[model samples]
Target: MTDILDSTAAGTTRGAVSSLFPATIGRFEAPEDRALIDGLSRWVEQHFREQLGQRPSCHVYVETLPAEIVALIDRLRDSPVIRELIVRQVPAGSGFEPMKHTDELYISHYNKDRGGDQGLFDRHYDGNLRFLSSSMVVRALIYLQSDASYKVVFGDSRVEKAFTTYDFGLLDFHRELHWVEGNYTPGGPQRILLKCNYLVTAPGAGARGRFALAANTAVFYVVKAAMEYSKSPRTPAQKAVGHLCNLFRRLNIVHPLVPLAAIAASAIGVAVLAYVVVTP
Candidate 1:
């Protein structure tokens, strides 16, 4: 997936610096291989089976759908929107989660029991570590839960400070806490949801499982920011783009789902960065 770099796709519309968004937000690019999804789904299956061993119910995402969706995500990773939206939007580094992170994080469900925490639970997700590591640019996490009995609870990092969910007390990793929740799957299994696209999982989106939490219930998205949130001035074209973006969003037309939203957001992100580069 990381193979397709700075290279632009076929249908992406081009605009000069002052006229685009910094990055893609809603979906991955197109022309991706469906088999890739299949492979990933299988990888998720095996990953859980072998690693978690207990097989605590999860969902699997194939390639064709999300792979394409994440591609646009990767594109956004390199855009100028990252600078404008994140850097100018917030503190220089206030918005970062972990404050700093390494590369990828790996978890073994089998350790849940062996790790002294029972090794398996229906509620919550395995993405605790990943989410914590999101202090860097932006971060997209995919949750492939067991599609059985589980729920992803999201709350403010402050609120979560008072209570605990996944029993991280037994965890030996870093101690920085994230704000989230968990629950058991009472839907009698067979319950699954795939959030193919849409990034920026900030607060207010919801603190519950509107998302599918299963075996392959992975949260996938990209991040190109490492600053705090802020308020900034918008140029005429910038405001126009923002206005159009709002229109599309009201229509429930974000890309990967709505092609244009993805395009507009990405172009706008790039433009944001380009504007910053030449202005001062």
Candidate 2:
């Protein structure tokens, strides 16, 4: 593993122009553990089978992860490469403190043919509060299955190459605009990826930052629900409204207005719902 990190295979980018073009930190192949990879693949398949009725896509949080998965996460967290990348982002003299919370760790499985989740394919940042905070939060994705449809694009870069199994990469969570194309055949392959977020916080985030984070989180859930609702079969009126919301989302790819547009669309939805309910 040390040799791998020191090799020319590792790469990092800095000073991105905007949120659309995020600074990539590193890309490296994780230590080969065929048994562990196979085990996790089976585990994820079974979990979705039992819990999600073999849905096209789903994610499982780290809290419910098996012991082996947890152990693997610990290993990744302690890796020298990941540690160095994280330390570089820390504010000077602010101190480095590792967070143990698992809220931002999860494993996602996506099958294009099974109607993948919009959230997974959407062109959006990683987290709800990502744009609101100055705290450096990095997103790491480790691939379990390789697929060409899973793409990451930066400024002027045409769909970065697909990641192979055991290939893991780290990028700025707040700045990267990742999305997938709508190219799904009837029986395409499933892609399973483990995702983790590493946060390096300044000592005093202050009350405003906390409030902004909470508010953004709430809005995110509401917008998520709206997106899910739009996907289902709906009446003509509902379909029209859904289209409008989708438009807002597409336009949100431009930074600074991403959250604002989402907020406006969500607020419109709430107001309409309120009027409908009270107009009896």
Candidate 3:
């Protein structure tokens, strides 16, 4: 099978620099592969049907994916063109190295529904290592089928972009405020998106960058816990915790530090509880 970059697709690929941030977002038509697209569409339909039912979306880990899908992702991650695109966006004299391993790769499925804002995501920055600056992370989306929905991005200005079957788009995680829109038609087509994230580090960042990565790795467990609470909060306390996390998620767009403060408060509360339990 031809690699994604090897396709003879007719359209020109392009990248746009954000006016307000040291970042870039772009879209390009992916290589035409009918069988591959069909396979992914089928997988999304079946997986969501049996696993998530009417749920708007679900994340399927990379390791659990079929061999072909994994191969495609591997090819995309290692693509030299993609690497060059990312490198061009970084500041001059800064190092640009894409990490070899990532735990943030997943297939996201937006299941079909009868309109209204039920399955759409709201304006929010893509989640990344909160400690790292926004310019250090890259996010990619590969659409598997055509849909009427639009991916709206807000940087210095508002821009709405549409994706068709096999469209590849990249985003500056944490720098771009983005969300999905226009999926409200009754019984609209389901959207299948393959999402991937990469971490970039300047060599000069050195020990501090390593420390940030390690800290973020540990924090990912907390994030998973919050996701579980949000998904299925069985008790009153759990429900409250879920609501607080949701609030933080929304407030994060106002300023990244807002979520950091929330995390700090939660940590302090836990520490106080521990101290009370252990004290004589």
TM-score: which candidate is best? 3
C-alpha-based local distance difference test score of model 1: 0.28
Name the best candidate (by lDDT).
3
What ranking emerges by lDDT with the best candidate at the front? 3, 2, 1
Candidate 1 regions with alpha-carbon error over 4 angstroms: 1-35, 55-101, 105-139, 144-149, 157-180, 183-280
lDDT of each: 0.28, 0.51, 0.54
Please give the distance, in angstroms, between residue 188's alpha carbon in candidate 3 and its true position after superposition: 2.1
TM-scores for the candidates: 0.27, 0.63, 0.70
Q: Which stretches of candidate 2 lie over 4 Å from their true place?
A: 1-21, 25-35, 50-55, 66-68, 94-122, 127-133, 156-159, 185-189, 202-245, 255-280
CA displacement after TM-score superposition, residue 185 of candidate 1 (Å): 5.5
Better of 2 and 3 by TM-score: 3
Quality of model 2 by C-alpha lDDT = 0.51
What tens-digit string does per-residue lDDT give for candidate 2 at 1-280?
0111221332343232122323443544444454566566677667655643444344455657767777866665556666566545444322233333432333334433212244446665544444554354556676655566555554333335466666666665555666655454335555667666555434454554345444544654565455445543246665655665555556555654765767788899999999999998
Model 3 agreement with the true structure over 1-280: per-residue lDDT tens digits:
0011221321233222222233344443345344555676777677667653444345555657667767766665555545566555544433343433333333334333222122236566655344464225566666666664655455433655677666666676556677765544545666566666555544355575566555544555465456544554557776676667667667887787778888899899999999999999
Pairing residues by index, what is the TM-score of model 3? 0.70
